[model samples]
Target: MCGIIGIYGNPEAARMAALGMFAEQHRGQESCGLAVSDGKVIHLYKSMGLVKEVFTDEVLKTLPGYIAVGHVRYPTKGAATKFNTQPHLVETLFGPSYALASNGDLVNYDQIRARLEAENVYFNSDNDGELLVKYLAWQIIAKNKDVVEAIRCLMKDIKGAYSCVFCTRKELYMFRDPLSIRPMIWGKNINGDVVVASESCVLDILDVNGRSEVPAAGIIEVNADGVKVIGNNPAQYRQQNHHSYCVFEHIYFSRPDSYHFGENVFEVREDIGRKLAEQDKGLEADCVVPVPDSANFMAVGYSAASGIPLSLGLIRNHYIGRTFIKPEQTIRDESVRQKFNVLPNFFKGKKVVLVDDSIVRGTTIRKIVRMIKLAGAEEIHLRIGSPAICYSCYYGIDTPHREELAANRYSLEEIKERIGVNSLKYLDMNSLRECLKEPDEYCYACFDGKYPLEKE
Candidate 1:
């Protein structure tokens, strides 16, 4: 998944959007961008770094706008690079350029890209979001219609989930995929500036009034006049609590400090550890140690409930940027190892209750377990916060193939043997539901293989 934000009616809308992007940076750290409208034209700036690193003072000065949209990207399909970092801008044949910042994937991108390319449409990037804009822009140009109508028509052709925002010189348009696989929220700052973002924690940082989340698979547009729904078909945007919101958003990507899908991530993750402890009665794990940054919060909860002390067993190399994004197996493996260094001092003479967010292919998790064993950890009891991922995420998560999924192929005992862990315990699905105060509201499709939205 990615992080996106938009603001209208602010003198420094680009700056404001950048700030919001920063707050949601945990949702995506690959690339960051900001594009803003100054009433005359759209100015754009983006790069391959975190918000603070990419939006230095000089970069911010170049973007002038009172209407702005920004994005922090975690590539699901495209390469994460300066070449792909969005707020992708397109100059329309009829009007000034517009910028789009998207936060989810489109399953039909391949088909659509082929259609446009067959018709000789020049594609600037292979990014799914950029392709979407190209299709919309081409339609707008061909039909001589407003971008909104073009987007509405464009929706008929796309077949994947998305919660996206686009900004023109005078307007901000926002929409979610009919399935609403991703979460997008909107609010207003104290200054009456309209804002939209992926999570409410960003709104808290901006002192914005946390309005209710926009409806799933719905459309809303904001300008100087404020927010309003413009378009959506009842069949596609059917309102229901299907609850297919991406589980990874809570288990991993989103900050533990945020709230989404009607549950506080921090609280749910804590409950995950508590529940895991309750289920795994006789584990011989010595100390609770996190797998690094994302697991730190849940590990704390595990430690408190398990009567074990928490320690940093893995030290992350924070400076390791996307230097190894090649779509190859060996490179990805080497990248994960390079990004983390086992802390022998932390694991010395200790049996570890290793807390991690989620286990996908179990590649990194397995490697981490091996690292702990190499570090002289006497025994390893691996605990996970979320239910086992047994299915592929058609939404936005980068889950491995189902055949390769650890939980799908191997039982907990089998997985423990494969990883050489003393014991392994994953949270029970029902127990995970109980962890959430609003159990029925959020989607657990990844765990249960229940898709919330139908494909067109």
Candidate 2:
């Protein structure tokens, strides 16, 4: 998953995009970039680092424009290098005419890229965002298709999740895949400048008005005239009759304060916790201790439902990024050690109920359980807020291989033994669905192995 932002009609478009990207820094940490158009040329700058470190005030000053597109990348399709970082820009005979940044993984990337290559189109990077821009540029420049029509063709041809922000020298366009697997919301800020982002929190930070999801297979264009919404019929592109948003967004990916997929993220997490508590009817514990940050709300609901006092027994180092999103296992293991610490004398002689969003590799949770154990906790009854991830996610998340997931490899009892917990339980699939308003509209392929769009 990644974060994308677009700003139009704002003189400080680059600065505003930087703030929005900073708000969404949690979505990605590997690298970030921005493309700003001053109505003449699109200036592009990107680097492999945190948003705050890369887009400093001095760096933002170099980019002046009334239109901007920005991205924060968590690598899923390509190697973790500068070459794969987005917002990918394409220049033509008329100079830099298009820059595109997207949040999603393409299943038919190789097939489409080969088709383009067969037509004599070249590529600079293996990143899917680059392929998207090149595809549109090919259609607009070579086949002479309108920009909106080119996006429609893309929706029908590409098979996967993509919430995109595409900008030209004079206009900005936002679009999403047919299933709406990833979140993309847009509205006008108080300044009346049009803004689009991967999450509502970015729109909140910018004080946007009338914010709404960029519709499924829908395209919104912002230019000198005004904003125009192209509400495309998604059924034309896919066989699925319902939207397939990623359920993990509510469980782990999104910030609790951010709202998307027609539900409040934090509320859904709390509901998950309550559902988890409902599953443990007879269990007793001294305190409910949650893995900090993401699982904070779940613990709140769990404590409330189970009548257990919530304890902040673990302290997290905010300086370290999310361990789950780290590209390599070695890096993730190291991050788990550096990211969390036990509170002084908090867990001593206590029967603790530990809460976490979900277990992917099981490495991070094992270390955390070990830390609490060494701190003198008498028992740790681990509760997962979502169902066991038995399959890999292809749309946007980094669970690329089934063997890499703990649940896919081990039985429930085996996972409990491996994590060194007294008891382990995950929120069942039906219980998890109860936490959402429109559960059927979401994707649980990571848990159920029912892929909405097969890889081409």
Candidate 3:
């Protein structure tokens, strides 16, 4: 997935947009970009790297304006390269150039690209962002529709999740898909300039929380005039039926410190851990050991619920970046070890409940279980924070197919054997629903296999 932000009316909008993106870097670590408009023309900069690494002073300083939009992206629809990075700018019939950044996958991208290509249009990159821009430009150019109407029409052609922010020289706008599979929130800044972003952390980081947050899966447009909502007709999309938010965001993608869809990810994870503890009631675990990073919050919940001390038995190397490619199998195995180091003293002779976010292809967890054994942990029991991932996500996440999933391929007992754990306890799907006060409000498609959007 990705993160998008926009600001209008503030003179230092470009800087504000940068701040928003900096807060949103965790959502996507592959590339970052920004576009600013001074109520005239648009200026742009994008690079394939982290937000801090890509948008340095030289890049950020180059963008000057009272209005700006930015994006931090990870490649789901295209390859990781500067060519595919976003804040894609193109002038529309409306006036100055408009830049767009998206936060989710569109399953219909292949169909849309093929349909457009047949009409004598050539493309520069195999990027979904490019295809979206081409479609919007074509709609405004070919159909003579206004930007909003063009967007409305174009969205009808898109399939899957999207929580996006768009900006022209004049206005800042935000939107999410009918299902709102992704998270996008907006608040007002101290200057009364609107702040629209994918995470509330942007508002927290920028001190822009006066305005609570925008409604999900709808349009939020802010200009010098004011902010307004549009295309909020739930009936329109519901008439066709496409709705399911991604539950994985709360489990892994989003930072526990952030807020989205009115649910605190940290709290939800804690609830997941408590529920996991409930399922494995009275388990004899000496301490809870989190699989550094993703499972930290859940570990705390398990520790509190089970009355076991939480220990940092495993430490993560912060320098292991989001993008790392290994040319050999041996190197790949070594890379996992480098990312995590077991504290021999902390884990030695302990009955450890290893808290991990989720198990996918099975190899990593299997290897990690072996590693902990070598670390002298007396007994290794596994507790997963999220329900066993039995499906692959066609969305932004890098998940393997259902058949390839460890859970899908093996029974509970078999999985425990494969992972070499004393026992494996997974949070049940029903337990997941109970954790969320409102089940319909949340999407458990991955667990229940309820495909909201039509498949490609």
Top model number, lDDT: 2
lDDT string, candidate 2, 1-456, tens digits:
999999999999999999999999999999999999999989999999999999999999999999999999999999999999999999878444899999999999999999999999898889999999999999888888999999999998899999999998999999999999999999997789999999999999999978999999999998989999999999999897899999999888898889899999999999999999999998989999999889999999999999999999999999999999999999999998899999998999999999999999999999999999999999999999999999998898998889999998999999999999999999999999888998899899999999998877
Model 2 residue 71 distance off true place after TM-score fit, in angstroms: 0.3
lDDT of 1 by residue, 1-456 (tens): 788998888998878888898888767778888888898878888887788988888888888878888998877767766777887898756566778888877766778888888877877777877887777778877667787777776666776677788877888888877656678888787788888899888888888875767776567878767678764553653446354566676677777778777778787777777787787667666678887677787887787787877777688887554322224457668878888888657777887788887887777777878877888888887888888889876666666368867889988888888878877778888887787775666667778886665432
Off by over 4 Å in 1: 81-83, 117-120, 144-147, 229-241, 312-317, 320-346, 408-411, 438-443, 453-456
* Candidate of highest TM-score: 2
Count of backbone collisions within predicted model 2 = 0
Model 1 global lDDT (CA atoms, 0 to 1): 0.77
Reference-based TM-score of each model: 0.88, 0.99, 0.92
Where does candidate 2 clash, by residue pair? none
Q: For residues 134-180, could you state the per-residue lDDT of candidate 3 as single tens digits?
A: 77777777778877787776667777777777776787777777777
Error of 1 at 118 (Å): 5.5
Candidate lDDT scores, in order, read 0.77, 0.94, 0.76
Q: Which candidate model has the greater lDDT, 1 or 2?
A: 2
Pick by TM-score: 1 or 3, better one: 3
